[model samples]
Target: MNPWLPAAPCAPGTCAAHTGRTRLRPVAAALLLAGCAWVLAGALGAPFLPLFGPTRRERLIRRWSYGAVRAFGVRVRVTGAPVPPAGTPGTLVVANHISWLDIPLVAAVLPGRMLAKREIRQWPVLGPLAARGGTLFVDRDRLRALPATVRALAAAMRGGSRVVVFPEGTTWCGRGPGGRFGPAAFQAAIDADATVLPVRIGYRVTGHGAAAPAERHAPAGAAAFVGDDPLPASLWRVVRAAGLTAELHVLQPVPAGALPDRRALARRAQRAVASESANRSPESVHH
Candidate 1:
């Protein structure tokens, strides 16, 4: 088995559960179409992003990302300090992998090049878009390619690009224990001397009676895109779900040199995210 291609036990049949209430079929359909258009618009416009100044480019990426999420009828709630602007040292934005929405959610705040599996570069619409957006692809199936991928990541960061990565290597049911963070991505940060920013990505159902009292505001399984779950099925589940909210908790940033090795850094970052994931309680929705 390939070490980089770890299997997640979260299958769609068992993990992706939806609230009893959903939007009308017609409304959900419209939202899905709008969401696709918004995404395509961003992809088509990606080439022009480099023409703008860094500040303006960041602003455009944030706006487009937020708009894409809202277009799918999902509300976004972000907490914690804003990500530091792109600069010499750059940043490695790390997060838990839940659904396809994770990509845009991270970009909504910290717009940067993405570190994704090479397979994503061959995925239909998203593949082309990712390539056009300057995504760094890794051939996880080949152990020999690992060093090259790390070097590429370090180069991108040293060039002042904030790189986002989901070190879990697989998606999980957001409500339960997530996959472990692989230490490979941390190596790039160490090599580049970049800042490591751990962000927790979660989804919740909102509105009156949307969930049982105990489960209210808990992570929503409807948004999970785990093992063998078709992308279309996941997309439709999100659109039909009533009052879905995507939450991004940006934790404190740590310098790469603060830790002795990549494994230590990975464990520290993972612990921070796991703590936040476990401590979710009913809270007032602000939006």
Candidate 2:
């Protein structure tokens, strides 16, 4: 009935805290502090800090990103510890998308350039860092832009910089569907003749169970999903709550050259990621 607590809705902060949705305050505070902490660190890291050069800077950024998220109770579990061909030789890394949280989680945890959406580079606090971290973005609406974007992505790979792309295109709530991605990124990797490695990220719930009217705490996956809207209002609600520790598993690398073709590679990638995770389902990668 109220703006803050409207009728049932999917987006955060529109439903009552007990409506099996995010409680406003915790979510809001978490988002606020997360932003501030990330921004402040980068601001201090400075564009010319020398200490934050491409390699060092990226690692530093990911570490801080992981820490900020940990404070929010969203533990990131990365499986398939990077299988860099030739022992750290440059390769293109692809994975399925779980949430917007995936970007920071991977960026902060993995060392490489990320194939991200052009829009994220415009976000507050995170945008600048992404651009500097060498993240490549594709504007789906602008098809012509693909050629240039792909070229840049290839250059990074050839230059010995590991680039990560989420062929899934967008984020998921990590419960419904695994995710879907376009074939363009894959084609680009093929064109570059870069080996593709698949990675899986799973966030497990350590506390609580299914929903109950009087059970006002949290559900199974609550530790990772509750009140995370990247909005000031919702992040505030998660800060004080204790979140579960997430698990990460790194799978072996999948080479494009070993597959029959690009399509086959994509299909096998889906099966590989879905094959042996304890609880998560199969994941599909976009081209």
Candidate 3:
């Protein structure tokens, strides 16, 4: 078992439902409030955001994100040192792709725009809100769009925006290593002469402050947004489950000058994240 997350009384759902129910009223309220925050962010916040400036919008988003995560009943834990705030000279974060929760988990800690798949832009409330929040979308499947995407990302980086990119390109269940990091995204950092901060994400279940002896010690996949997993189903599973925590291992930042090219930078970032994921569980190591 990973020492950082010792076997706790919470084994995902055992007895956690009772706790969830006990606090159901407050959690529900928080969720409603979170939803309202998003709506306001889209309607009022983003539109008049420039009048207040990026800092205000960032603070608002961070508050909403933190509340949203709490409402979902997932606690986020960070390991290693924190990365520089967005707009820092060289602040690009590259993380592993796991659950849809990964976005909020990171956003709550480090507020900035994310590099997401084109399809996410069409997602109902999430898509619109994300766009209004400054998220940059890319059509990964279109080769022609790659250059423009990278250029846009680089420009954002140069402008001092903290940009997050999941080099894995796609999500994976914490079952094994995720898809290979496409070198394209690394160009943003390269072009901007920024450092790539590598972050590894994993999950654990809370046991309502009780010791969960029945814990199986397996990597929690309940929150994983893998293939064919419906968003509604995943959200329900996560929100209803008690004591879910996202473990973020923020590895050392890989400087752009240290790597010769984008591909090298991509491989280095992937290895850093994969290594951290492997450290989560002995059998969880990547081949």
Candidate 4:
């Protein structure tokens, strides 16, 4: 295994058990169709995204992202001020990785060029869409390519694009300690003198007011797509889940140069995201 590859202990058998109420098969099928159609629509329309100005493009991206998650039967509750608008001298949006749903959830609020693994560029439907949407792909297995990836990220940010990255380098179960934020992406922010916006994503299964002991821990895991879990299985689980709410906690933005180094910057953003663990109560407000 490459030393740079990040892994999480969370797995389908151990961490992705869905104990909450699930939707009927028919309902889940309908939701699955809608979600897939919405995603396809986005892919088909991606080529024209550059025709619109920044503000309008941002609006379209946000609206499409919202619809995508809603089609998957996931309700999103956003907190904190909206992300800094485009043309703000570039912003690096960092968040924890959980489910595949996290992609649309974050884009709904802060639509930007995503920093993704290079292997995604070869995936079936999402590959072309990601490329058209200007995703930055980094080859994680090649340790020597680190500097080039950082340069590309810096160039994108310098061009005034908000680049979204999951700096932990892998997905987690979102119940315990998330992996540490790698410092490579933070170096791009430092190089471009861009602001770092940290967002925390949490999920909870609703309609479980009086849940049993086994079902109590079903919130985050219901939507977790960690380890070697297949994509279709995770999607089916999400569509069938009852009243799954995805919470986006948009924490304060750390101003450019606030931290002296990439490690310091990574630590600051990680701390902001980790703070959301304290707000894990079920009755948290939504906006």
Candidate 5:
């Protein structure tokens, strides 16, 4: 009955009833853990910064991300292979941007420093966490900032750490392609001679351990942070929605060394994500 809740579920029989039930407890748990996580991250992370490496803070972040995803009551099923565990050198991860949840989802799956928009670094609790967790902030509005950002990212990649980047620049509804990826970040991998890992993020509805294909790769009633949708409103929608699932497909890695140019690398990563995204549409399935 919450105003933020979507209309009744579309599935037939008991599936509809099950889908209509909102999981408020998970949301509550997530909120509580989020508060604790941030507080601990700031309080504990700062003191140890001089002693332990960045991985300590990253580990804490990863734990919180896993908890947050569970709190959403959504199951994340990962397909394809992982891109060599956390320490592999010269690894650059790129994925399609969906909901703000994509942040935690990626953190939960691939623990690494994220290339986030400058705005995210200014958010409330997230700002502190991102700062402590080693996020690379970019001012998308400043053309002059691109080269420096690219150079910094290149240095980070070459230092033997995984860097996750959303090449789509901005978020989009999973119903279609997320637009062309900018070649600037790809230049980082090219410069560092890193392995480009293309990842596709999609949504689905699950019931009785089976998934129903989403409309435009987004499950019916799935949460999407697109357009002018406010963060609170999106969170409300997510908590109210039922049977939601996040599918993270780690597509094959493209070697940046073999690419002719940064443009070629960008196009290849975009194609991998876009093709996988299209594959999740209704037409891809057989009757």
Candidate 6:
């Protein structure tokens, strides 16, 4: 149960296969050591540092995250880079969820206030820091409070602060029974007629060991995700195993004005994201 070893191939298909790391292990380790220490200094210990400017703080957090991924020896290869013009009104950036590392990966690429579940706000070291990042926390089951969260997001957009939301509501390694996406989830945008940009996240797995998913009693891989977890517990094994290459691909952007109703727009954008996603389920990957 080594945190550095890669994930063991078990109970899994080719959805998001990932393996191999020796080549970049040292660099990844250095990034993590330096990046985590920097972010922790900024995030941990009560009150958090008084971030003078959101822009400056955003850069610090983002640089730390990108360093984290690279330090993990995880290569990110974005495709169809989303090039949204600057000075545009705050738009809603919607995307699908993949690994736990996803939050940092995408955020490193784009800076936008995130909409995350209330659970994330309770995380030990990262929780308080995320709150300071201006992320909107919500109790998913609180239908009554749902409106409030949506409104807050809308308000942020109106105020010129972009927002990112995962309407699917939960994470699934991007496979098997995708959590339902609330059709009206983007109602605020439709209400304000604001622009909604759909983003997609995918993890590419490679190599032999990358082909297995441990069983129910899979010797503590997922559970080993407590502290020092952005890099999965299985990372070291996966790295030592060999023959692996993972590439990240960011899809094209969809203009809100071009689509019809919010539902239709959501569906079209969903398809675009799924298509552009490299981790599409094995069965669907063939399509």
Give each model's clash number.
Answer: 0, 37, 6, 0, 0, 20
Q: What are the TM-scores, per candidate, against the unseen true structure?
A: 0.93, 0.72, 0.79, 0.93, 0.79, 0.68
**lDDT by residue (tens digit), candidate 5, 166-251:** 88776666655567788888999999999999888876665543334322243433456765556665665565666677777777
Question: Model 2 over residues 19-96: C-alpha lDDT tens digits?
Answer: 234435656475557657766676556466455455566556667767766656565555344434233655766766
Q: Give residue 265's lDDT in candidate 3 (0 to 100).
A: 89
Poorest lDDT segment (10 consecutive residues) of candidate 6: 215-224
Model 4 quality (TM-score): 0.93
What is candidate 6's lDDT per residue for 1-287, written digit by digit as tens? 32422232223233233333243666545645654565576575325435336666556666766665555445454545544644457677777654556666766766678888787898776788789777889776666787887688778887887777877655555444344455555776766557777666654433345353221111212211222334444344233322222333445655666677767877876776666243432222110
lDDT of 3: 0.69
lDDT of 5 at 132: 70
Worst ten-residue run, lDDT, model 2? 1-10
Q: Please give the CA lDDT of all the candidate structures.
A: 0.85, 0.56, 0.69, 0.86, 0.70, 0.56
**Superposed model 6: Cα runs more than 4 Å off:** 1-39, 42-57, 85-87, 175-180, 206-248, 276-287
- Model 3 lDDT tens row, 1-287: 22321122222233212222223655745654564565455545455666766676677677777666666666666666555663466578888877888887788767777998888999877887678778899776666777999899889888888888877776776656666787887888989998788888877654543454233234566677765567765666665555666777767888877899989889898888887443443222111
- Give the lowest summed-lDDT range of ten residues in model 4: 278-287
Where model 3 places Cα greater than 4 Å from the true spot, the runs are 1-44, 208-217, 277-287
List model 1 lDDT by residue over 92-146, tens digit each. 9899999999998888878889998888998877898889878999888899999
Give the higher-TM-score candidate: 2 or 3: 3
Clashing pairs in 3: 8-212, 9-211, 9-212, 10-207, 87-160, 206-243
